[model samples]
Target: MTKIFIIAGEASGDVLGYRLMTALRALRPGLEFSGIGGARMAEAGLVSLFPMQELALMGLAEILPRVLHLKARLRQTVQAIAAQKPDIVLTIDSPGFTLRVLKAVGANGPKRVHYVAPQVWAWRQERVKHFPGLWDELICLLPFEPDFFAPHGLHPVFAGHPVLESGADKGDAARFLARHRLGPEAVPVVLMPGSRVTETKRLLPVFRETLALLAPHVPNLAPVLAAAPGIADAVAAYTANWPHKPVIVRDVQERYDAFAAARAALTKSGTSTLELAMAGVPMAVTYQVNPVSAWFGRRLIKVPHVAMINLLAKRALVPELLQEQCHPEILAATLLHLLRDDEAAAAQRAGYAEALASLHAPEGTPSHAAAKAVLSVLG
Candidate 1:
């Protein structure tokens, strides 16, 4: 029997971890999986050693109060790895918890693979020194990451962006439109406020105003919202007063269906952009954080672009409206341009193709490529 210990913290990591587990199992049957993960990974048979939320804390402020609890969980995770003595130890993201556990396991432990290399290139270049000794195999999602790490005396496998495996393009748009009772004249617009509560709180009001502004121009406009499960109710509350009520989809399948039905998308500047790009939806990215955070981020961020698609394309493939530029008027105008201009939309889709092609693995899908990389540890 083959055994592997895997740990994933936070929702995104959980999704990636589940996909990797599914791919690993497809390649090798009857494999044993044990470690920490959320509900998604549990579907793939990872009974988490502790609540994944324990390590899901994002900022230092959140983690400081739970230091003792996290320390104990860390010890427990270290002990579990020692007891299982699995063929491989796989850690996905959550540099706070996963990296510590990997470090504690030491170089003498079973072959270790750390997926989603930390974005040291973005801000924390100094953190790169500690990472060289952490993982036997480093699996990065971005195409540029292997180049970034190789120069630092570390070899990494670019497994392609996980968003490619999202099944975003496989949605039944006709069925989705029919189910929503949208007619041929109706134009479906996808609204991705964000997956986090803070983001939804900031963006939904602006999104509502954007919709109100575009309604007269876009005939029979239909809004489809892609919201995270935790923030769904909040999204509902925020959008209750909007003129055109959005059909909010909580999970991936529903969101993908909505994406397929969409003529254009208004999304925050993140992975949601990639999701829209994968579904061939023309979009404008918008983001507004607290004044101070935005101000600091402007200085700290090394990259020129905010949208991942643009970053990957090495050009302004999509419009990014940030901070003061993220007003309802700007977002509304940006979205209206996408809905009205066929040539501009076509150009964005072409760039989407170019950007997404960079995410293709040397063979098969990204998940399969990642699985092959992880399995290489044994042979």
Candidate 2:
């Protein structure tokens, strides 16, 4: 029996970890699986060594207060992994926490396979130089990622973007509009704050303010808030006092449908940008961090654009409003532009093709490709 210990620190990583676990089960049925993950991975047979949320902390400001707790979890995780002595130790995303745990595991640790290569190309280019010694195999999701890591004595296998599959099966636009009481003639703007509670708390107010700014100009604007899983109640509570409450779509299928039907979107800066692009929805991306964190990030971030769609396209496909620029008026203006200008919307939608093509996998599914890489490392 194969012993596979996995670590997935957040919602996105949990989803990917679940998919990879299912694929591994398909290849080797009797494998023993244990890890740190959320609900999705729990359903995929991961008896988490610790509550995954303990390691889900992000951003410098957010993580500062939790340093002692994080270090404690690190020690706990390291002790667990050492005692288990699994054939493979797979860490997915959350480099801050995962890498520390990996370092503690030492060189003699089980075949270390890391999924979702860190964005060294954007910042911290020096990480690539040291990464070759940390992990045994690197499984990347982007086609161009291998070029960045391979030259550093690390052979990365491009398993295609996981979003490619999730984006493929979307809901019906007509069904979504009707269910949300949105008329076909009315303009619908989708607001995706983020999947996490912290993200929702940070961005929902700005999104709400942005919507208010647009309401006067775009009459009868039907705003639908796409509630990321497990955070629907938080989204609702935050928007409870609004003059015109945004319709919250919590269902997975309905959220995708809402994306398809939306004229434009105001989303946080992350995977949602790519999700909107996959749905061919024009959007303006916005993000905010603690002022000190923003100041630190400004120095480290080398990329011209922050959105993945723009990164893959090597140009700005959509407007990005970050930190101080993520104001209601500015965000609303760009979204209003997307709603009003067909030419601009069409141009942004056109960028999606190139971005998707860049994420296209050659033969196998991303989960299977990732599983193969992990298995190869174990052998």
In model 1, pairs of residues that clash are: none
In the range 287-357, model 1's lDDT, one tens digit per residue, is: 88767667666777887787889998999999999888889888889999999899999999999988988
Worst lDDT run of 10 residues, candidate 1, spans: 54-63
Candidate 2 per-residue lDDT, tens place, 1-379, comes to: 8898899988789888989999899987898988799888899878888778666666888888999988898888888888888888899989998877777777787878889988888887876676767888888987878998988977788988778767533758888877767786878898887776667778878887888889999997989998866668878887888976898887667878888788899888777788888888998988887888888888888789998888889998899899989898899888888988999999998888888788866668878878888888877
On the 0 to 100 scale, the lDDT of residue 375 in model 2 is 85
Error of 2 at 197 (Å): 3.0
The most accurate candidate by lDDT is 1
Runs with alpha carbons beyond 4 Å of true place in candidate 1: 53-76
Model 1 TM-score is: 0.90
